[model samples]
Target: MRTVRIWAEHSPFDLKDELKKRGYRWSSGDEGRPKGWYVDIDEALEADEVRYLSEHIYRRDVDLFTQIITPFERYSVRA
Candidate 1:
């Protein structure tokens, strides 16, 4: 599966709902040592779905986070 490493400071605001729509979960897994949030783009997602998740949704929101801080750090993941 293809995986994209999203920087902790680049996460979107609606990350929880958006990722849920795509059937994938996010995790920092101790990425950046708690400096910020980080999520991965997994290959398990359908090819088309990946674009929506990354470019349209993830990337789009990330572009906005360039100004915010805490909003970029908050996220919920699967247990």
Candidate 2:
């Protein structure tokens, strides 16, 4: 599986329709920064899918807090 990070100042839901249009699956992040979502693309997804995902998911002005990490990698949740 491949991972991509997306950031937007507004509601992450803003991109939901586009995601659905492009056939990408997503999951919400854990506590704290709940406004963000993680988009997971199947390794088998086509190049067009990846390109569309990168183009439409982000807003121009917002600082997107994102990182491309593997599913097996560990991330700490700070309180």
Count backbone clashes in candidate 2. 0
- lDDT per residue, candidate 1, 1-79, as tens digits? 3454443344466666655564444445454343334444453533445345458655642331112224234354534
lDDT of 2 by residue, 1-79 (tens): 6665443324366667766564444445445444544444444543444454446655323444555657655355544
lDDT (C-alpha) at residue 69 in model 2: 56
Candidate 1: stretches off by over 4 Å: 1-9, 31-46, 59-79
Task: State candidate 1's TM-score.
Answer: 0.33
What is the C-alpha local distance difference test score of candidate 2?
0.48
TM-score of each model, paired residue for residue:
0.33, 0.38
Candidate no. 2 TM-score: 0.38
**Candidate 2 has which clashing residue pairs, if any?**
none
